[model samples]
Target: MILYHTEPDSPVIEISVEGKITDHDLREAIERMRGDLELNGKTRVLERIEHFTGIEPKALWTDITLGVSVARKVTRAAVVADAVWIRASMHLARFFTKAEVKAFHVNELEQARVWINT
Candidate 1:
């Protein structure tokens, strides 16, 4: 599941993911982000992943394509996850995204929020 939090005229987008993610969920989230980018030109992202079991194969593909498509439009991305593998995956994702991507432990969510807001 994915939850998005954004306020009117805000340049920061907050997303929270839980459990398994599907291709539809990814596509919807990406589309919303694209719409925000169109209006804002550039934006920062704060993503929090909790109990993320995994994603479907098709979801992975959609994520890659959509992420690359909007790479240059994102200014910064802060990912908060406790899993080591998730952190490693964030590093790999950075190569495909233009945003400055950083991974934080769950305990450091406040710091991550500050970084993204800055």
Candidate 2:
């Protein structure tokens, strides 16, 4: 399951994912993120995903779609994940998107927030 919250006023979009991530959850997160981008226009975004246990292959595809979705709307995107693979993939894939992508551990969430906000 995924739990998401957006602070449009603060111009920050935050998303939290827990348990195993399925395709449906990924789609929902993507849709919500898109809405935030459309609402705020080129805002900074923060995604916290340390609680996420695993992901389905379809969810992996959905993640790429979501990245593209965000890139089209946001100027910067920061993701916090303890998962090594996710961190690696995001760093490598950032070059393909318009949004500058950065991944951090959960402990670095605050720093990431500050970096993106700044």
Candidate 3:
């Protein structure tokens, strides 16, 4: 499931993801994110992943497409998770996009939020 904590007035897109994700979930999330990007021009993101088991390949494709479309518009992104693979993936993302992507341990969720907001 994808739980969004987005504030309409804020430029930050805050979301929490758990369990397996479907294309519907991903598409909905990305659509909201796109709206934010359109409104703000530049955006920041805070994603907290917990017990995330998997995601459909189609959802991955959708995420990739939509993410690439908004990549240049994202100024910063904070990913909060304890998974090593997720953090490693965030590190890899730095090379592909201009955004300053940071990964924090789950315990540092507040720190991540502060960094992203600043």
Residue lDDT tens for model 1, 1-118: 9988888998999999999999998888898999999998889998999899999999999877776787668889999987878887886765677799999999999999899988
Give the backbone clash total of model 3. Answer: 0
Query: lDDT for model 2, on a 0 to 1 scale?
Result: 0.77
User: Which ranking of candidates, highest lDDT first?
Assistant: 1, 3, 2
What lDDT does each candidate get? 0.88, 0.77, 0.86
Clashing pairs in 2: none
**Candidate 1: what lDDT?**
0.88
Clashing pairs in 3: none
Residues 1-118, candidate 3: write the lDDT tens digits.
Answer: 9987777778898989999999999898878888888887778989899888999999989878785777667889899987888987886876557899999989999999999999
Of the candidates shown, which would achieve the greatest lDDT relative to the real structure? 1
Q: What is the C-alpha lDDT profile of model 2 across 2-67, one tens digit per residue?
A: 887765376777778778989998788788777776777767767788666789999888777665
Q: Of the pair 1 and 2, which is ahead by TM-score?
A: 1
How far out, in Å, is residue 76 in model 1? 0.4
* TM-score against truth, every candidate: 0.91, 0.79, 0.91
Model 1 steric clash total: 0
Q: What is the C-alpha RMSD of each candidate to the true structure, in Å?
A: 1.4, 2.3, 1.3
Better of 2 and 3 by lDDT: 3
